[model samples]
Target: MFKLCRLKYYLRNKERLIILQPLTSSLDEAFQRYSSSAADKDFLHRSILPTDHFQASLPRLPIPELEDTLKKYLECQRQILTDDEYDQTVDIVNKFKVTEGLDLQKRLIAKDKRNKHTSYIAKPWFDMYLKSRLPIVLNNNPFMYFRDDPRPEYQNQLLRSTNMIVSSLKFMKTLRANILEPDIYHLNPAKSDNMRFRKIMRMIPTPFVFYGAYMFKTLPLDMSQHKNMFNSTRIPRPGKDELVVNKEGRHLLVMRNGNFYVFDVLDASGNILEPGVIMASLHQIMQDQSPPNTEPVAVFTAEDRDVWASYREKLISLGNEETLKLIDSSIFALCFEDNKPTDPNAITRMFLHGEAGRIWFDKSLSLIMSAGGNTCVNFEHSWGDGVAVLRYFNEVFEDSTKKSVVHPSTSVQTDAASVQRLEFKLDQEMKENLQQSVKKFNSTIQSLDVHHLEYYKYTKSYVKKSGMSPDSLMQLAIQLAYYRQCKQTVATYESCSTAAFKHGRTETIRSATAETKRACTLFVDNHPAVSVEELKKAMMACSKKHGSLTRNAAMGKGFDRHLFGLKILAEEEDGRLPEMFTDSNYQKINHIILSTSTVSSPAILIGGFAPVTPNGYGVGYSTEDSRIGFNVTSYPPSTNAPNFIECVTKALDDMYEVLEGRHPAKSI
Candidate 1:
């Protein structure tokens, strides 16, 4: 590992040292960092299939130099630590650099060489999720809502659910056929997003496809995660969980009033069944008024992972093994709620972690709808992150809302035999276990608070005209809000996709920068000595710093995941933990007090996740043409979500005023 004395060399030379003799066109520091592009499918193109160029089109996720990562880590440490604490951390990090860390870094690079198909962190990342003992409910699962159906008549709960299922199955079918449009982010749509660009790409050989794409200024995101998007379930196992996927499975699973129903969405010929038949099956479940099952077996999914795993074994031993496989192998789950949500907050809660009795949390994607006629996708996060999920989310919403497969007036036929309600023969022990699961679910969901805001003061146009990245502005406001609330800075995590590379997952954009700290202090203190010019400069500085970090994280050069890989290596080695991992400073930086992500799209209304830490805040926001929206969740008393949102609103308005050079936010 390079010492602090070599920092200048690290900066001057940023080219990655690739381990494999493979694709020559792989990008290095010279390429532009990724800007996440929305999901788009082009049907008119006659050339290559959507994912045909996946292998050739993107580079592997890069590993930053050990020196670069350490420098980045130290820079962030200074933002939240005092001089004394920072000094202590520096000493610890330096010691680790020459000793255990050097060996681990070398081993990590060698392992990356041996595994050319994926990033070094891939297996460890999967193990990180699979080995967690926490329940996947509020702690791991997240929900994203679709905009309401524009044609009010289509908003009937049964009709809407039917269309979503139909659209989703269609998406699955198209995807498996490999004809669906690939997930491509066009940097300049005017140049790369049209029919002409398609023609050029069609003539190019598969080996040169990425070069062709580069000519058009488009980047293809990794489609590796898409394989698990359908016909998959997170199966609970002792000590560790596993993702069980059956691509051959074509049936649909629907949960309603604590009952489970299944029907084949695909026929023996591997074709989507008529939408009328699918809608008729859902209609049967929707019309049923059977009292909820007293045991509510599905709630077991919300129990702690190992506890649920044990119960799962009990289920299999009780002659429900076939039944369990059927549930897991289904394409996905569609849940019909007994009651309509009264408001937006209610909707957020319903989808985030619904009546545990009605949700199969293990399914890769669960389509949930309330009796009031609205829906969202609550997904298991272990198999993938936001890239694959959001793609499916956007495509399905657009297809279902604009080109629905079923309507209220469509033919209705009820066949009890068409849908199978899974029956599990449970013993007394299993039934009692069910009750325990429900109680745990209620306790966890009840302890949380959610506050959503749709601020219409400004949107994309305003941010761009002001010459700032919209996401950066949003991050700045969050830091100020936290400072305004607690009067100090803490570790902030904003997720940036590393999907631009092969088998890429996610990287962290540590949003709490020194500039943000200074800006937050200035805004909150409102000291007369701090001129408006100084405050404006600080805000601008924060925006610039945030943008740079975002780009670096997207390019797979962030410090968090690199440090994570090293820490995991240290744990696997036969020795005491490295001091770098043991340092109190390392613990503080990894706490992730403000876990935030942006879920912005025209088709999506909002998305949210529970705080990763009990006392932290889970912030989900979206920036639209008309407004910028936020949905904040926290465990109350430890953190008041409502008060934080109030502070967030003030911070946004204050920043906007500063940008406009208008009535100085309170102190002018």
Candidate 2:
């Protein structure tokens, strides 16, 4: 029996990918050698600059040929639509190509020219993300779990909690100082590459803050008081010591017992609070026996963005000014859960959409830690892509595990204020609104299904040994699995990063390629005449085609984004909906049934997203040298997640057997 592996299995087998080894004895030799070289000094001097200064100078996202886009769009639709529907789509395409689309393309070009500093499609993409009907938390946002600290001394919730907060403040300091290096792709610079990183790192705990992604109005933490750092291990017992205060909103929101609390994380002298102080304050908040909130205002975050936006305006009209500022200006949310999760699925469930009073889903990064010491982040996707969050956690993970630094004793300040609860003034009408939000949240979460699977049969090395891209092979296998189950090719959405472009997020890499369909059909048909070599060749071809599409998307020449820009301009600017967007063919292809994305981290234990559509399955996977893991989710009854997992596992095995020439051509 091929069964899914547990978190313990992953913990046992998970090996860190070490990129660099620390030098022991040659440290001075290396520095002296570098210092003696005049060329090295000159190189260092010229290479140093502000991380994101070049952001405005990067090239704008380009416009692709309209006809070629139409052709590719038709190719994608052909796999999903019926003959009559496809023909109607073809007619619509023909009409669009000769008429409004061409003029729209010209307008897009003009728009790009007018907006050289930003991508032409960036605004529309952001607006579309916010305006989309799907709730961002589970439906769109992707979350990842970092492994527990290896040091048993730091495993306690209070110690680990303070460590996470301190490390996060340190990272924020790095951002404010502009010392973090810009991210690079393909050993070359990308437009708006690091800018997205900055955006996500600073996302306010609010939805649609000022129409664009929110920037943090961060307060600084002064480290002058502590000679080294707060020791998170058992060396120093946790308790209350000194209070923390911030002038510029350097604070975190804590959601507990269906109530919200706001407090500064820095002192009056601008110094970070002692871990003991934070731990003691946390205990006080958790122990408070406040009346349980029948309806929490934060639940409004889980509502649809449009609905939330309108309701938020009503909230503003009610003049709860301080409450609004507390949510909007805070750096991020720190959600403390009362119930300790028993297993990995429970962790995912809690982190994805926690039980009542355990989540504020609107925050870009919701640092969630359960009583059992399990921790994960439920991120807001509208602000930025997953890479930014991945990078942020990488820093925190590294800082959290580093050996504790001993600091000189400092006098504790006892008179500072502790964390305070932010009470909202709600009337019967507002209470009714919040009640409706809670009902909506319950209905939505109840309808969703999540199944996390870890497949350790093979990994990236074996796929590479077969002379194929690991990512490409994984995509092909996904297509084959979907084909086996659905018995027909469906339009698939594979997120390909276009961070190579200015302010780039992602482009749709249509995974249901003609090559993939051909390969899947051949495998499923079980044609006796087909040989192992032929099957391998077809699979390799599919991978190669996917690679090409991925490259095209990376270069900002993808069909979907270009089409999206043209369509948005036609509708929003010209007040005319294009024939292509309204056609049935367009609707069929746009219905993404298999939404997939690949995110890899050396320290991350698991990562995934909720299914975008009821009938679709959202697959977030990470490929390793000896294993591959997937978190598959969908709406149950209508779409079975377990069946899809079974199909994918079977497809992987079949593909491997055929590659090794160990099994004859068999049904997938």
Per-candidate TM-scores read 0.91, 0.80
- Candidate 2 local lDDT, residue 102: 82
Pairs clashing within candidate 1: none
User: Model-by-model lDDT, in order?
Assistant: 0.82, 0.68
Superposition error at 520 for model 1 (Å): 0.7
- Tens-digit lDDT track for model 1 on 172-227? 76677675678888999987786556544554556556655655668878888888
Kindly provide the TM-score of model 1 when superposed on the true structure, using C-alpha atoms: 0.91
Model 2 stretches with alpha carbons more than 4 Å out = 1-49, 186-247, 268-271, 287-292, 309-319, 403-417, 664-668
lDDT of 1: 0.82
How do the residues 1-668 of candidate 2 rate in per-residue lDDT, one tens digit apiece? 01113322322342421211133124435644754575321111111223453344334466888988888888888877888888888888999899998888888888788976677877888677655665666766677887888876676566677677777766665444444444433222242334333333223112222112111222111111111111110000112111122226656788876788877776664456665566556666666788767768888777766676666667777877678677655666778777787765777788888764457666656788887567787776655676567667787887767722211232223343388898777778888989888888888878778877777777888888888888888898788888888888887998877665566767899988889889887788655577778888898898899889988887776799888888788878878788788776677678788999887777788887887777898888888865888888889888888888888888888888887876544643
Candidate 2, overall lDDT?
0.68
